[model samples]
Target: MPPIAILVALADPTRCRLIELLQGGPQPVHVLAAAFRISRPAISRHLRVLKQSGLISEKKFGRENRYALHPGKLAPVQRWLAGLLPAARITEAPAVVIPAVEQPLPKARRIPKPAATPVILVPALAAEAAAPAPAKPAVSQMGFDF
Candidate 1:
């Protein structure tokens, strides 16, 4: 909705390229990935980010998943651009001023940081010293020990 948010969404290079590709028409994930040098999984991840950002939308049709540009999600972006630069400056113009389809925004993902080393208050020797030793079993003075 905000200009900064839109800019942040499009900041990723992969996402920018994805938007460019979707401009052509709706395409399957495999087709989109095959067009790029990166692996399909990588492309899928990029698409996931783009989808989360509301730049794209996906649908399952039969055996394939199709993705297309969602202009509604990009309204804030176009509006932001329109403010900074005049509409006439935008070279590529589609029939609709902006597609009204809803763009799926990506979820807020948390990236886990590396685990820190645990600090032990007491030394191993000190711990052993603090522990009680097991008592020896008492046996009768007999030839066979119990």
Candidate 2:
């Protein structure tokens, strides 16, 4: 199959999971659908896409159809990825440098003296004038204060 179609087939989450499931071996449509919460038709649709892309192949068995992964069809993709593997497998760690920074806080300014205000001494008021009266006691009969 074309590389683009293969990639498109694997792009979907459902199809990717289906591929993972198929890796164990071939599976019938109902068996694959049982693995997902979605309707059986939805699973079939994903399988159809995978089969059309040549990422998978379907076989006839009595009355049922079984789908299996076609790993051979992924040769181009595997080779392309193999080419990138050399760069991905690092032998030496890359260097990292952090530059030093010097920050100076602003100096405090001298505050000017304020003009003085005159002060007079007075005796504090008696407690009764400053304190509020206590609330009246609540009485309940059917008449109640909350």
Candidate 3:
């Protein structure tokens, strides 16, 4: 798979969420859309991106299309990240052993003193209301008074 294409596809939040959902099994666009607030068309667009990136596989099931994760495409990404791990790197020499020092650690001043925060207490509202319930909208007496 094209690593850059896969990275670009997975970079989107919705695409990543869709990829997570696909892990359980293949799902049609409608089913995927139900898991999110976005419209079906938007979900389809995301699927297309994943497909173009070779990160997902799509199959036509009946009249609907089902999408599944193409995990192999992510192998490159995994390998790239794995290479960054210290343990994964090869060394010409054996592991070094450093002696432990008995020196006391420097004191930690973790929390700074609380600065004075100004408190503005709002005064209580007046008991009297602004006005009555809009004067009952001035009902028309054209027909008849109740």
Candidate 4:
């Protein structure tokens, strides 16, 4: 899977929260949503994105779906990060930082700040003013709201 897709899925705060919950252990959709501040459907949408990204896997038990981390897909990401860090001490003796004359010190990588990105803020009253009256979905559904 493309890294961008995984990044996009987690770009949403709700999806990030859902992933955080699953990090502890597998959880039912209702249980996951309880930790979120959004509506049930909104959480469902976040879960959908997560499922598509291969970050999470869902198992159906009767009417409910239980989601868990997909470690197989996650291992590569972890390995990639581990590759960036300094290697472990070669011997039991206290490790010495012997600078190689051939290779200069590795430059620190600069990470962009998340806060530098633009954010869209919606005030309660302004949001309410922009809200459209409820339009029922075309199909009836039974789902849990935690």
Give the best candidate by TM-score. 3
Q: Sorted by TM-score, highest first, which candidate order results?
A: 3, 2, 1, 4
Model 2 spans with C-alpha error above 4 angstroms: 84-86, 89-146
Shift in Å, residue 93, candidate 2: 25
> What are the per-residue Cα lDDT tens digits for candidate 3 across 1-146?
33677788888888988887887779888888887766888888889989998989999989999998876687777776667675785333432323223466578888988999986544453333433555566788774446
Between which residue pairs do clashes occur in model 3? none
TM-score of 3: 0.56
* Poorest lDDT segment (10 consecutive residues) of candidate 3: 91-100
- For model 1, name the residue pairs that clash: 52-105, 52-106, 53-106
Candidate 1 runs further than 4 Å off: 85-146
lDDT of 2 by residue, 1-146 (tens): 33677887888888888887887788899988877777998999899999999989999999999998887787777666657685664342333322223356578999989999885544475545667988999666563224
**How does residue 43 of candidate 1 score in lDDT?**
91
Q: What pairs collide in candidate 2?
A: none
CA RMSD of all predictions: 20.6, 26.9, 20.7, 18.4
Q: Model 4, stretches more than 4 Å misplaced?
A: 79-146
Candidate 3 segments exceeding 4 Å error: 86-146
Compared with the true structure, all predictions reach lDDT values of: 0.75, 0.77, 0.76, 0.70
lDDT of 4 by residue, 1-146 (tens): 33566767767776766776776678898988776556889888888888998999899989999999764565544555556554742223332323222445578999876666665666867787678989987664443233
From the highest lDDT down, the ranking of the candidates is 2, 3, 1, 4
